[model samples]
Target: MTTSPNAPMTSPTRRDITAETGLPYVPPGTIPAPASAYDGLPRDTAVAGDRGWDRDSELSQMSKAVIATVFGLALLIAAFAVIGRLGGWAADYGTILVYLAFFLWMSIAGRVFWWGADTLIAEIRKKSNTGDCR
Candidate 1:
């Protein structure tokens, strides 16, 4: 493992490091393989933060938004149906208004939900002291 002082240093491969140290070698600038069964588990449930937890949280939030939007649409339909039965301007133009309102509501609600999820994740990471904010 010794080199001449005048020799140029070259990047070492994983195999070279492994052979020299007799241990598992991880390449530079790469995450190492987990050392134990509990590695990479969620911080709340385990000793360290899960590297993919943010991705899972995002997917969960998207599914929730979809479900909420669907439920909102159903309720809007039911309300519009009841109002349209009253035989007023509602019956004539309420469909367009309802669609517009639904879109607006979805945008606002989705943004809020996403923001809240991000904030919660950030707070959890902060409290756990397991994530590098940078």
Candidate 2:
């Protein structure tokens, strides 16, 4: 059979395709079957009843930021100690340079830590709301 070129094309139904191809047919936009009843649950349910800190909470995020900042400070101190031992720069400049460096480090680190915490909290909120934490 022939059809006119101007005719509108029609999509075949699942039954039509299955009959023609002798294979199981899945309609377009059909969602796949879930593996288990739990598969449909929200991702946050894993920690729903827990008494511990919520991983996505602002307090938890801020604690993480504090820990990270402390770790950075430790590294900065270690680096300064190593430099002092190798070049004696600290001895020449005394505590003044150390204070200045510490002030600068705290200022920059504070900003970075807050920014990181804010970003992480926002992402967690977005994922939670969208049910796409995974």
TM-score of candidate 1 versus the correct structure, residues matched by position: 0.29
Cα error, candidate 1, residue 8 (Å): 84
- Candidate 1 lDDT over 1-134, as tens digits, reads 88899998789788888899999975567987669766666555733553644544465544555565556556556555655354454467786776666567656656655555565665657757965555
Best by lDDT: 2
Models 1 onward score TM values of 0.29, 0.33
lDDT score, candidate 2: 0.67
Off by over 4 Å in 1: 1-92, 130-134
> Which runs of model 2 end up more than 4 angstroms from their true locations?
1-91
Per-residue alpha-carbon lDDT of model 2 for 1-134, expressed as tens digits?
99999999999888888899999976657977658645666756774455554556657654665576566666566656655353355566776786677667666766665666566677679879999977
Clashes in model 2: which pairs?
none
